[model samples]
Target chain A: MMKNKKMIILLVITILSLTVLTACGEKKPTLNVYNWGDYIDKEVLKEFEEEFDVKVRYEDFGTNEDLYVKVKQGGSSYDVIFPSDYMIERMIKEDLLVKLDKYNIPNMDKIDDRFINLDYDPANEYSAPYMWGTVGIIYNKTMVDPLTKWADLWDEKYKDEIIMLKSQRDTLAVALKKLGYSMNTRDMGELEEAKAELIKQKPLVYSYLGDEIKGEIVGENAGVGVVWSGDAVTMIRQNPNLEYVIPEEGTNLWFDAMVIPKSAENKELAEKFINFMLRPEISAKNADYIGYSTPISAARELLPEDIKNSLVAYPTDDMIKNVEIFKDPTDIIAEYDRIWTDIMSEE
Target chain B: MKLKRAAYPYIVWMMVFILMPLLLIVYFAFTSGDSQSFLDFTFSLNNFKRFFTPTYLKVLTRSVNLALLSTIISLIVGYPLAYIISKEKSKRQNIMILMLVIPMWMNFLLRTYAWLTLLGRNGFINNILAKIGVSPLNLMYNNKAILLGMVYNFLPFMVLPIYSVLTKIEKNLIEAAEDLGANSITIFRKVIFPLSLPGVITGITMVFIPAVSTFVISDLLGGGKYSLIGNVIEQQFRVTGDWHFGSALSIVLMIFILITMAFTSKIDKEKEGGGGGLW
Candidate 1:
């Protein structure tokens, strides 16, 4: 009986090794794209895969910081990544992204001139604009007065009826902007002042959220929230009484962009994917599905007139002038993180 | 000869799955770089030094305190429930245990998110409180929320071990104590409690270790407002891009847990007169 058991064990080991070798040998020309969750349409992905005959593996992250960490760790090789404006700048400084060869991407001409020469990736050398929007107040008109500024988040009337993003950059930017300081202020005193103001506003705040804030706001559980314009558009569609406003004191203007990582092995496939996404019809579909503004001029023409004219989707030129794009604070990140944590820990 | 062949598969499985990954964590903990090449490994102490910072130390202590609190609370709540279940008829005992563990079959994150919906400012609890003209409590994004979440998640760990031990106790011992004119309280203290000591120790260790390392519940329930040690270690790998520091924090946490386990074992040995043995 014992001899029979030994023979069975040997047979099992042989079978397992064969399976492992077979799995490792089957490799295909593939592209791995990492982006935010609920930001892509499945039909578009299926179409891209069918047309190119290349396997597309997609992953998601809740925040840009989460994406940055995974790319930095070098755990998985990603052909493409979508990072926000400041994060792209940081990755560039760290020499983590590969420069795009514009020769291969004919659709680069479809993007508007406004998005091409942004400070994050000057001259459109390393990254392509994927989506762009402003941070703003999303509120239910029936539950509260119109909120027009960051300070309105601290109003006692809306106590426990407000939600804010939990990100250090966005929350701190709002506090800094409300205190009349630069959003990227590196001065220690100004940051401390901003931290104090945020602490004071904490009592009236409900909770910090990201994508989940939209459902809460739409359910009428939250009266106002600091949310992205894309999420606000989704919430407004669900509850027409919802209104979005770019705070009077100004807010951060952020953009998400696609870039190839320096460690990417399939550069050709990555470029092909970027060019595919930039096609006007494809870009318009993405914009309609994600409910975010498109930077492609051709796509904008295809949008419905009401969506094209919506101020929340496309802010007035004057409002755009007041907004500032975020810059990468290379060495000052640790200080900002420390202040944010300390503020959160306080009573 | 037959035994040697039979042991080969088990040995190979252990070496491949368990021992290999442990060896890798140790290797990477010492090695430094964004690349996989280990050419410039100089055996540095910098990674370990980062854990000595006051900020990280405070988070570590807070994690230990919260874990201890959760373990103690779960033990208090779970012990009576386990005893009651064990006392039930054998057929009912299985059903009761199944009912207790049914919630655990769902994904942990989903359950935590469900709690968020039930406890948020506009959640069910607050809505009901508001209807009665009472002010809603700030319960979702605070220490209270973290504690409630920890206890709810880990209570089963405390229950199963104690219940298993309690059910195995012979009924004749308790009957003999009652026949000898001993009161119910005295019999329970002497006969029942000592026999269940091993389960209590196992339950405490099981609940405490996971609670200390738990990051997601605290992050979601605590509103990312409070920084626990788990969050600090996560930030090192995620935000700071400092793998060396993260490995050091992990080593420190490992050392702390080892010391705790050692101390608990020593106490248990003394209580058992050093010869009864844990096994």
Candidate 2:
């Protein structure tokens, strides 16, 4: 009986230990990260996962709007997101983001001073800059005449050969800049004027496009196209026949930033990840990989000479000195949206 | 009791997924755009008022026109194909149905994206045209391209329902008509076409509703220039952060779809009651 009792106890003990071990061996905590498509280097995610001993779940959204809707839908709990300036402003106003604890992110000093404390997040809270670039006209060298201003888009010579940005704010901003007004003009009259201008210019535009603008430029489908500087960088490198110019008329100098949402389950992990990304080597690698300008000042040295010195990548200080960034339009956004929808619907 | 318990989870799922969302939309439709507070339900007709703008009405009209066009095209293309398939042997019929369904296995979005590359200015078709010493056709970023996409994607919807109804049709009726000295055209017009009325209605309802509310096709092929009701609703909810307006537009769209469905179903009933003899 004693021997039998011992065997029973031993069996129970072994089973209990096995259950405990199996439970402990289950999946690691996953860090849910949402970012723009093709915005990150693949190896960098792997590196972060290995360094942190946690699984990384990365997802992509096509636009700031997509990112907002997905986050609002509550279908998934995302820890970190990368949204552009105006979107960050909207998120901040909506109270969708948490006030980031800067103490946890000590590498903040590495960011270029010029990128710090801008219009979107003036106090340097809630967001950390990831990449900085401008919205400008990228032109085919041999096909188009000399271009210097946003008004050049309306030139008759480039009629049906000019591609415009499909975006609401970016396209509207072009007309607003040409009119020598703020891109974030809340004036109803000024907005009406701007809308009229876009409508008048619609015939000259070949097609209002998004990413396909690059392919169109490279294929010589369009003589000139409105594009982001980072895209221009990549396109310029691919074909030497392309040249990017920040229009003489002031344009948008936008910055995209990393932020932690209030719904993040792993807030500490998110901060750690942001700090990890802020490390000089990682920032440089990301900038080099994405063809976007590094926000970190120290990372410039780590970049290849060509990328660091590329005119498209690094614009002269005068170009961006008085440029505007998008603000959270709030109720005024409806007007802006109305203009875009109306413009598209016009026959 | 066992069956009821088994069904409990499904009921809960329905309530959570379907009924709850509908309720939320109804609630949002009537409320103000400032949804920052739980008690901020300050109700208004502003969303409805805003929707009636000339611009929005134009978009609505365009959506209806395109949806109607695509439905007609699908009927013209799909009805013949379904009839031919129904005439096949059962073994061959099954294979033909499978072949029709196989293309849908990839994805609707992927298929639409494929059209983007094929119809683009420097795309394959344009390349071929260039090689043939013809100027490349300006095909992309237009209504024609969107119509093509809508017809291609929704043709399966048009075919499947008609095919199912046709296959169910008894052959003896057709044979009797033929034995009575009715030719193929007379037999088809008198017997087959009348019976297929319900299937035709179902197919139209399926294809028209989806085509009307199609955002992706318009965005991809229409080159972001053509703004339909779907794109507007999407922009309102996603881009503009205006749920009140989005939900209101959705309700309006829902009403339009519902009216169409009711009209189609009424016609279906009349046909059935009339024994499908109307020309």
Best by lDDT: 2
Q: Cα miss at B263, model 1 (Å)?
A: 2.6
- Model no. 2, DockQ: 0.55
Query: Which stretches of model 2 miss by more than 4 angstroms?
Result: A1-30, A69-78, A93-101, A219-221, B1-10, B273-279
Please state the CAPRI-style docking class of candidate 2: medium
Q: Considering only N, C-alpha and C atoms within 3 Å, which residue pairs clash in candidate 1?
A: none
* Candidate 2 chain A least-lDDT 10 residues: A68-77
What's the interface RMS deviation of candidate 1?
A: 2.8
lDDT of each: 0.84, 0.88
Q: Candidate 2 overall Cα lDDT vs. reference?
A: 0.88
Top model by TM-score, which number? 2
Candidate 1 lDDT, tens digit per residue, A251-289?
889899999998898999999999999998888888888
lDDT of 2 by residue, B146-250 (tens): 999999999989998888888777889999998999999998899988888888988999999999999999988887878899999988877787888899999
Model 1's chain A TM-score stands at: 0.95
Model 1 chain B, TM?
0.91
DockQ of every candidate structure: 0.38, 0.55
lDDT of 2 by residue, A1-347 (tens): 99999999999999999999888658676788999888889889999999988889999988888888777666688999999998898888778899888999999889978888887788989999999899888888898887889998877788878889888888999999998899988888888888998998887787888887888888887789999999898888888888999999888988899999888999999998999899999999998898999888788789999998887889889777768888877768788888998898887
lDDT of 2 at A257: 94
